[model samples]
Target: MGDGIVVGLGPVEVEAYIDFACPFCRQFELMAGPTLDRLLEDQLITFVRHPMDFLDAVSTTGYSTRAAAAAAAASDAGMFHEYARTLFANQPPEGGPGLTDGQLVQLGQEIGITGEQFPETVRRGTYLPWPPFVTQRAIGRGIGGTPSVFVDGVAIPARPGPILTAVQAAIDGAV
Candidate 1:
């Protein structure tokens, strides 16, 4: 699987940015899930999923990256979202328990990516390198930690309420 980030929102276009593997990213997944779902249903925000694994070095992302690659391979098999859900659901605890490559193939199979090719994909580390400038941009935006959200290159502050408000504002501004 190749590495390409999907960036876009709304029925037409809104704002999109590179995302890394941070706990905050998962939090955003939870926090924004509802609004994002509504947007998807209404075709108000057409989210573009970009696969970026900034946490590659971080132990937390090791499993995610492998699983993401597996999902990517599964995408080639026409089951991207299914593999994604399975991977996220089974993400191992950072700095603690984790899934091995064998486990990843298992997940792929569970998500309907069943094949001998699945494990090979996971082993090859097929995903592309993380995007450049994302960390620098985040840091330049005063982000020292992860899960930083931005719109049109403007940093969205890191707070559930503030972040949500900022995201909404960004979407509104774009519209």
Candidate 2:
């Protein structure tokens, strides 16, 4: 049960454990997305995003699980990156009801992930178990929080600056 949504085929492997409902994870994404994109473009690192649901209980509607499942649907449609960014950009506050299934579908549509499969997947909760599974696996691996980052199998601070620095060091070391 490999749960990572992998992007890129670079030499160094960078894994990010995140929860959709986590504000800090959102911040990390906003801060590091571009740099990660550039690194992917340059084939410096293989980015793997492990979408977890540890924060599902924080939201009134289990937003973390729902959103992560929706992201899996987006990944099926080959639009995971866009859908994730949109979700983060429109993140609802904790303790509130997260976006409805309809809104998730709409977001996917807005990102050009059309067709019935995506919406149907969300509505049917097809990947509902995925987030929790990944969350548990992360916990089993000693990852205790969201936005945990690893560069070349070495844990690094989830902050943008440290992530960038660690990724750069990994790239350099590979040379």
> Highest TM-score, which number?
2
- In the range 1-175, model 1's lDDT, one tens digit per residue, is 2223332345333232323245555666666556555555665544444444456566644554555566566666766645655665665655543577777778778766766676676677664233333334444546555554554445555344654465566557752
Displacement of residue 52 (Cα, Å) in model 2 is 0.8
Off by over 4 Å in 1: 1-4, 7-9, 12-21, 50-61, 114-117, 128-144, 151-154, 157-175
Candidate 2 lDDT over 65-146, as tens digits, reads: 9999999999998888888989999888877889999999998998899889999999999999999899888998999998
Residue 175 C-alpha lDDT in model 1: 21
> lDDT of candidate 2?
0.88
Report the error of model 2 at residue 76, Å. 0.6
Report the C-alpha displacement of residue 157, candidate 1, in angstroms: 5.2
Total clashing pairs for each candidate: 3, 0
Model 2 TM-score is: 0.95
26, model 1: CA deviation in Å? 2.5
Per lDDT, the best of the predicted structures is 2
| Steric clash pairs (candidate 2) | none
